[model samples]
Target: MPLLRSRLLPQLQALLDLLLPPACPLCGANLPQGPDQPPLCPACLAGIRPLESPCCPRCALPYPAEEGTDHLCEPCLRRPPPFAWVAALGLYMGTLQSAVQRLKFSGAIGLDRPLASLLADRFTDQVREFEPDLLLPVPLHRDRLRRRSYNQSLLIARVLGRRWGVPVACRSLVRTRDTPPQQALKADIRQRNLQGAFRLLGPLAGERVILVDDVMTTGATARECSRVLLTGGASAVAVTVLARTPRP
Candidate 1:
């Protein structure tokens, strides 16, 4: 009975797919019928601009020019970040930007799985090398979390945690206070805005942590979160985001 049920499941899913085809979340285009197919379609996938080479080794900041090798950016040289490095799926532009904004601001929670899958596919090798034991999402202040009803970063982190077989430290790091939004603020102001905003719930015994977020704009948030984690006794911290904002 179990073997028959297992064999019939695929055929049942195929039949369901034939009747009610899935649509691309980004573009609303009908997707091909297949269990193995990605949530996004080929066209939308191609539209996402990947963050390629010629980037900062530490922060993953893409240099303005397109023809150089990976090297340390000046900022990192002057003052190093708490995290060892950053991994991102693409530059925050085009389809990727749209997807992130929708997931973040517009409450498209369903986008989490597809976005996490993309990140895993691109950075699996680097993440494996890092050998992270725990995943932590940048936390939302209780007030903001109440208003938003969901933390997109936490959602993404949960998906990645399941995929990589890592434990998610969901409440270990938290926002102590709600600050003004960072979207409209300048880089220096963004840094100050997040000052003393995070608190680590308990001490970490030299665990390697991967900080997950939806986007990296000025990177002030990531830096602050990593600092707190490191201060709380985390041995190493690395950041991973869905997209990275290019330098202006």
Candidate 2:
């Protein structure tokens, strides 16, 4: 009876799959109806390249070999960001951009694992370099969280935090204001828009905090969060993000 049931299960599942087919994440091809693999087609997954070598020491952009050393981007060398370090899971590009947008805007919470897994692989050493006592995802304003129903950053943070043995603090920071989207603003305007927007939830004195976020465009958000954490008495702040858009 056990053997029969086991044999019959796949046929039953296949009938259901035929009724309701699922699509591949990258190319929208129909996913096979079984536990053989992930929803993304193997061919598509193989073509998806992660940024592996001679990349930017900070932000992990694909750069020339000679330029990536010394652990500083040209911007960091000239005017260092407030956060001591930054790390990204992969270089942002075609399929990655779409995946990130889906996670952010289309309620594709399922993509969190793949994204976080990539980040975990890339930041192995940098996460250690910062030596955070805890991971704190950037706080979403109450209004936005209500509309979105989830903070994507926190989702990724939970995955990576569990793997890295670092505790995630989902409530240690509060968003005191709901500012306009940062993408439309200039650099100074972006910084000003976020000013006084974050506050510590409680005493974080002497705790080195790692701020996790989905994307970094201009570093304003991370910088703002670091300012709040530093003022709140955390020893230091380092940012971990899945992608960083190259500044135009």
Candidate whose TM-score is highest: 1
Candidate 2 clashing pairs, residues 3+ apart or interchain = none
Best-performing candidate as measured by lDDT: 1
Task: Give the C-alpha miss distance for residue 44 in model 2, angstroms.
Answer: 4.2
Model 2 alpha-carbon miss at residue 112, Å: 0.6
Candidate 1 TM-score versus the reference: 0.97
On residues 125-230, what C-alpha lDDT tens digit does candidate 1 reach at each position? 8999999999999999999999999999999999999888889999999999899999889777998999999999999999999999999987899999999999
Q: What number of backbone clashes does candidate 2 have, counting pairs of residues 3 or more apart or in separate chains?
A: 0
lDDT of 2 at 96: 73
Ten-residue segment with the worst summed lDDT in candidate 2? 61-70
Cα TM-score of candidate 2: 0.78
Off by over 4 Å in 1: none
- TM-scores for every candidate against the unseen true structure: 0.97, 0.78
lDDT of 2 by residue, 142-170 (tens): 99999999999999999989878899999
lDDT of each: 0.92, 0.79
